[model samples]
Target chain A: MAQPHDRGPDFLERFVALLEGDDVFCVATVIRSDKPGMPAGSKAIFLRGGGVEEFGFGDPARTLRSQADRALDEGRPRIIALPEGVEVFLEVQRPPARLLICGAGHIALPLSRYAADAGFRVTVLDDRPEYASAARFPDADVVAEDFIPALHALAPRLFRHIVVITRGHAHDLDCLGEVLHWTTDYVGQIGSRRRLAFIKEELARRGFPADALRHRLYGPIGLDIGAESPEEIALAIAAELVCVRRLGAAHAFSLRGRSRAEAP
Target chain B: MTDLALARRLLQLRRDGLRVCLATVVEAAGSTPRDVGAKMLLCGDGATFGTIGGGCGEAVVRSAALRMLASGQGPGLVAVDLTQGPGERDGDVCGGRMRIFVDPG
Candidate 1:
């Protein structure tokens, strides 16, 4: 059997190659240490096929697999036992996140562009053929003429982030009524607090759970960046998304002083 | 090949008059296969040129191509709307969001 380093290039090299290839592979590194067998900067790779390859680590394959599997399973970074002076850091690569912008209004226009810039796969939907046209959102992956059917057409759990910026309250309700009950990662709508309240009341009147509605709905959708322009609003939404996705990378890189090392 | 290179090659292929579907991950908010601009190409016959999110995303692109092929023409642009999931506005729990564009060369 070939060792991770002996196999060919180090995990970092292969990791870069895989990322460049657009292949989903995991990166397992030493985030924290109790003892020392692997240093904090130590790393490994986990492919989706359940294979574990390491670079700059111990000879044991089971340990690498065990650690990588843990990270993949938890969807979080993991720390594994190495030697007395070393620890292992494990980061797994999953499929890219999906951003579903359900309205192709002015907000969707910028949101799609900025979201694409931030690295989220974006799909913009609206009932109006004109609003949802491709010309409006050249950066968006998909622009559709309808919403409800499109939402139902997707594979379950495929959309990780959803933004509702449809034309009016009725459309918002139509889109949210279906989406609110599903187990999506994030669901936000664009409107003032009062508008959302009226919408929520209508939804509740129709028997949607008020608590679930409260927890799932994010009105006035964006971080408070004092954004007034369409482009500025897009920036706020994009910034909020980064705040969510880079959580682990930020912590680990700060700890290791590799803040600029791993990022492109 | 790198996604950037693949994207360039795809554009080259497009210039060659081959209808190509270019798929790219423009945004990802959470644990996802690729980052912004991670791209892939899909030829008319289902020959892949690049990748966007990988895994299911690749699968989705394949289907999108078939749809394009069924329409039958030279390379053009087709956008895939993957925002809503089963009874959900946008599906998937990875919490990351992405957009994939399928286009002809």
Candidate 2:
């Protein structure tokens, strides 16, 4: 039986909605194979069970659903090769992750613009009301509150890529101390080499494992772009954000003086 | 284009009751213009959404998709071989083979 691809809310709408929202879903697409059952473009979306709402869609094959389940569980996209050259591309997709700008400094304005344009849900946080006003950041959500309280509010849910570009070194250290505990992939700070080294030493003394700080935190953040102006620095940080989001565990080290981010 | 944009376009097509075939590069081996997951939509009225590495190769894929749409058949795979000798003349040779999944969807 041939069925039209439902572009209505029944199928594509839900797919787009899920993509725009927070729920993580896996879309399993049959790429190629000698398998006679499914055509090449046949696809199915599987949502995680238990509290994650699973809506209408004629039930998919158990095997296909389980494969998608595995993909969702692993949180990685992979090509599943069945016996006899059946190739299926299982894409684990979610909405663009939220980028937390810890300080609403000069860099924060351009950073928010660049990050939002690059498909990040940017949130600008600062204790200063003047700086954290929504007018300053049209593209980002502004939170006029102290750093730790706001971070605490955001600590529960994942998908946080924090940039600690506070006005002063002391505030930067304070923000770093709070966010270093989270298991997020990115926690970048802007400072000179000596300032960063001092902050790292302080963090180490404060009982954050030295290796974890070294690995998780990107001190003197931004790729080696020799950025001078605030806008250029913001662009570099935005590039680093994409680098960490896309190239996980590959460029997963301190990005200070690292390779320039490739333009998309 | 992002999948969201494609979905929005698809929804518009659905509203307009316009038929279309969606072509996706399911697999690409060796040097190819577009990699896997690249997509293009060929509407009934000879309009296109996005590009599958725009060239003669895309034109061929578009023709195949139109054929599939006319036939009212389900999704099918189009094996595009770009490894032809220079004299055969697409002029743009990438020496790669791409399997495009064309769905009259």
Candidate 3:
């Protein structure tokens, strides 16, 4: 293994701070190599907001930076083969993907737990302080405020997954109206087709292209997992969240799209 | 532990001025229990932080890491072949090869 720069706690502290932010980055480590001049233990950290930082990569730092960018874009890690059979492991270090639950109600409880367990920093939001109490969502952050303002203040772009499951159609519509403007991996709303239809019509009136956002939207939220109870529904939502996070939105099976199928 | 947590612990150890031997599975081929980039930190007096898949393979890597930690020894790689001929013991059969890089991080 080639020698790396003396990376102490300062390096880690900065990296952790980045994790807490909305920026995506990459950390490429030269883990195995036979190529001469390629330092086996060197690292190339590509901070998107900042600039590139190389630690003992010496001559091959340039190539590592390119690879890091590609890995960051893909939101995945890969072993890049360099000259003379040297392989560097490039790990995409994006800001922790988060879930924003618009209404902290029955489904939010188990959904928060499941999402947190699945590595999403969850934030449960509601106007009712009692429902949005921190104790209610032990594994998630809680915000007690009106849905739209809370969404705006929290910055919907920071949350990759947004689930709107408010107590009524009005709140859901307001939340979705705010969220559709942001580019998120998953934006779901829990409601019947009629309710969502009204919301979409209202959104179209409010200047958002409802059809344009359809590809990224998951209405009547969650995977078609035959869920009945609140916990099962939360599990379905969490499963959909994982699907969108890992396998991409193309493979996600939303109930809204499969409403024709009868319940099992 | 999560990779981030392990990284934090490694940084803490380095902050304390302790040189720790970190073993990372850089490459794995066929039926390996652990994938590439899996890491295990070997602290002083034989405290192992994580695992690149436990059992005999990890032990072999640990031994190589101990050798790398010796005074004047530089960072090096360890090759472990979990593959064996047919009729090999069932409990030990994973049938893969791993290249582990051990460095003083």
Candidate 4:
């Protein structure tokens, strides 16, 4: 119930604080209005944590709230039309995607750097202290020594992308097992095609659902770029990660080898 | 410019006890130069940061912002229509409509 004038400091302070956090929010701005009241540039901040502040439109608070919620749900910026020739632009601000690399080995070294350059918050995890040292991964936001403990400590939802690039098949399987059930946007594992098949079969035999691996995993990860070196493979994986992040799995389709008639 | 950088400048200006006007493009139609949420900051000393497009529309907003900063009143919204008059000859024949809100702090 606090007015903008009475809570001026509070509004600016809260805005500065919100900008520092890693949660999504929407800023709704009334950009056009022909009728009286609530002129253009009137604004409101709708926080994902369930709060609205610095609201300008007095009579249409409910409508604005619902519109902001829809923008956040869609995770995109959009313009919503209100009654009486009023249009509000809802600008959704999403937190940067967090990438969890479950092995600070050769590929992860370049992968972390590439992911960071692509705007992801990179976190590297390895069982070996030498591999996970801060000196090795200067680009990573976090370098943790213990894989299982690091995975457990992480807020799974925050880490939208998880890549398992450990030293051996056993380590890859172990890393995948820790995060298989966690809600994530992308889960990729690096291995040969035959090794991926063996790992999937082994996972199926270990009480995981038969379709779980297929449904929730991207094995032999990275697009088919015919990558021969570690850096090239890292680039391929990074490209795939960017594709999945921006386009989503359902919309990301390879156009190679497809006839014009088969193109969507 | 990034929103954080603008916000930081706004905060600094406010903390310095100078009256400032923040103008933002809330609604853009047709072929406006800037998209929605584009911002411009105006200080009392004739200093400006960021921009909501340039030319006549910005000049009009700058005048209004100076007035609002002087008046110390609540925010004012101004609609800029560039579709009027002859194209190219008018110096602002972008053929777009923008609604800018000027909030004083």
Candidate 5:
């Protein structure tokens, strides 16, 4: 049921309160429209458990609800049609995307921190207790002192993204060998050009199909953003993850040089 | 997947006193990937968690989020129709109608 406009918090106030709630919710804003009543930038909120809280000055909630439902089911976002000239912007929300970084090394440190700051839930895994300490990855949602088995325990299907930046090529290969059959949204590895080639050859020798290996592997891992520092490289890797999800893995390689740090 | 996680994270961020905007699907129709009750969260600094629709739908909301964060005022209810544009005319054949609510959280 819709709340009365006068007594309840204005659309914005209620929207803010809803966003603050622990339950996941999606937000849709009318950025542009063909009609006059719905002004640009008007917004709404959709919840994960199949509910919604909306407060905006634009199109009636009824008109937008039809569109919102479709967006939620498709696991994507889309514009909605209302009447002849009205339009609404819909965005979806779910559990924070998780990244399973299977190594707690120098690279993992900054990558974990950056991923957390970038709004991803970071989890670290390493066989070394010294490197897996919470003190090292304070921002990580979890830090484990075991690599392959711990990763298996988490159930690879639940992981949204996976990044392998272990100590050396052998370790990376071992991790890949254990997890190749595990399903995940995205999988990537960090290594030098030569090391990447070596790992691929080794995997193929060990029976990993050349095609599957090629499709799953993202080596020298990250967008070619000319990233040098850990933070910069983290951004590139993050960018690649975003690209793979947004544009699909097939298009990720083609989006090699486009880096828009500008927000919006 | 990412959208839901992002929304939850946004909620956590607000515990520290930051303001945010949330979007969710209250209704949907036809052949679409997401269903009713999908959500996406938008933090004040352009940090977002979730998906409503990808591409233009997300981009438009991201732009709107900047204002929502800046104004400190919520716009209340918002909606978007996916079938209203040319690119979508040829591409998104999901034929499903959807409604979204954008508010400050």
Candidate 6:
């Protein structure tokens, strides 16, 4: 529903509020147009859950809504054609990708740093106070104790990437049990091949769909970079995270054989 | 900088009851310096924060933004075609087009 101009906050005010809440929204600006009434720069704001909040030009509310929805679905900006030779740039504004590290161990330290530098809002979780302390993870946005409780407390929809690097195999299994069901964009688990296979078999026996687990889980995680040290392993995981973030799981193919010049 | 930083600056300016205009590059074509969604905030006192792109293009947008603030006009758009000749100015030789939406608050 369109908000009345006389009452409530103006467009800018509402826009700022959405930004403060880290809500997903789109700003459709009429960047190029041949018409006079709807000249260039005319704009409209559309929220993901809400309809169009404000529109400067004439009534093309339905078109703007669909365009905004498309931008949100595509997760990228694009020029959309409107009525009367008007073209708008639908700029999608999404919150930064959040990284939820299930364990605040040695790998978590450098992984959190690399993920933060790569623009992911990093949240480190561990039951140990000494490990999850703010002093230990100075760069992490959130350092929470109590792994399972903390996982439950977070709105699963907010976290797009999840990393399970607990100190033990049992902890990794427990973390995966809850994380696999969450609405996450990517899930990576650090372990040896034998441990990962054992966990997968255990999860499969426990009614977790084997197909979904195979599709969603990135076990023995990170690219096959042959990384040994904690720092190198963190780099490998970060690289894999970036690959999945940008190219999606299906497009994440091995670049071993392809020429470096031709590889993206 | 991030868009949140720009939004916070704009919000602070609004709270202070200062007349200001926000110019955002909603569309960028070809090889522009900045990507789409880049922003620049211009206050009535001629103070500027953030940047759409440095040099001639920003100067043009800033001048138009000042005019919008002075005239008390509503939001308007400014299209900067930097695909012009080489003798124009620094940072204007990127051979690109940018559509800046200037909104007053």
Question: Could you say which candidate leads in lDDT?
Answer: 6
Better of 1 and 5 by DockQ: 5
In candidate 6, what are the lDDT values of residues A1-264, reduced to their tens digit?
A: 654232235656666677656678887777667787776656677777756654565466555676678789888888777666887778888787888888888899899888877767788888888888889888675656667777788889888789999898788878888888887777888887777778778888777755666557777788778899999999988998888888887554343222311121
Clashes per candidate, residues 3 or more apart or on different chains: 61, 0, 0, 2, 87, 0
Q: Return the TM-score for each candidate structure.
A: 0.51, 0.71, 0.72, 0.63, 0.55, 0.69
DockQ of each: 0.03, 0.43, 0.29, 0.24, 0.07, 0.33
Q: Relative to the unseen true structure, what is the Cα RMSD of model 1?
A: 18.2
**Residue B39 of model 4, lDDT score:** 85
Candidate 2, A1-264: lDDT as tens digits: 212233344556677787777878887666565656555555666666721222222233345666677778888666777654566677777677889998898999999999887878888999999999999999888999988888788744654699999998788878888887777788888887777777777887778755666557776787768899999999888888888888873474544434221110
Q: lDDT per residue, candidate 5, A1-264, as tens digits?
A: 433232245544455455433444556666445656656565567555445555554337645665677777776667666675656666665556678888888778888877776667778888888888888888885555556567667766557688998887777887888777777667787876777777777888888855666556677688888989878888888888878766887787565422221101
Q: lDDT winner between 2 and 5, please give it.
A: 2
lDDT of 3: 0.76
Per-residue lDDT of model 4, residues A1-264, tens digit only: 322322344556666666656878887767668768777656677876456666555646455777788888997677788888887778887767889999888999999988877868788888888788889998775556567777788888788799999898888878788788788778888887778777777777666654555445776777768897999999988988888888886443341122211211
Error of 2 at A186 (Å): 1.8
User: In model 4, what lDDT does residue B10 have?
Assistant: 90
Regions of candidate 2 where Cα sits further than 4 Å from its true position: A1-9, A28-43, A50-60, A70-90, A117-119, A128-142, A201-212, A249-264, B5-22, B40-76, B84-92, B102-104
Model 2: residue A142 alpha-carbon error in angstroms: 4.1
Candidates 3 and 4 compared: the better one by DockQ is 3
Per-candidate local distance difference test: 0.61, 0.75, 0.76, 0.76, 0.67, 0.77
Candidate 3 CAPRI category: acceptable
Quote the positional error of residue B71 for candidate 3 in Å: 8.7
List, residue by residue over A1-264, the lDDT tens digit for candidate 3.
222343443555666666666677887777767766666777666766436666666657665666677777887668887777677777776556888999998999999988887778889999999999998989888999888777779765677789999999888878877887888899987876676677777777888666575676686678877888999999989998888887887767443354422111
- lDDT string, candidate 1, B5-86, tens digits: 4646665666677776655443345566666545577777667755565555567667876677678633222233344445
* Worst 10 contiguous positions by lDDT, candidate 2 chain B: B1-10
Model 4 chain A — which ten-residue stretch has the worst lDDT? A255-264
lDDT digits (tens) for residues B1-105 of candidate 6: 457667778888888889888888878899898988888899989898888988788988988988888887767778898887787546478899998888785
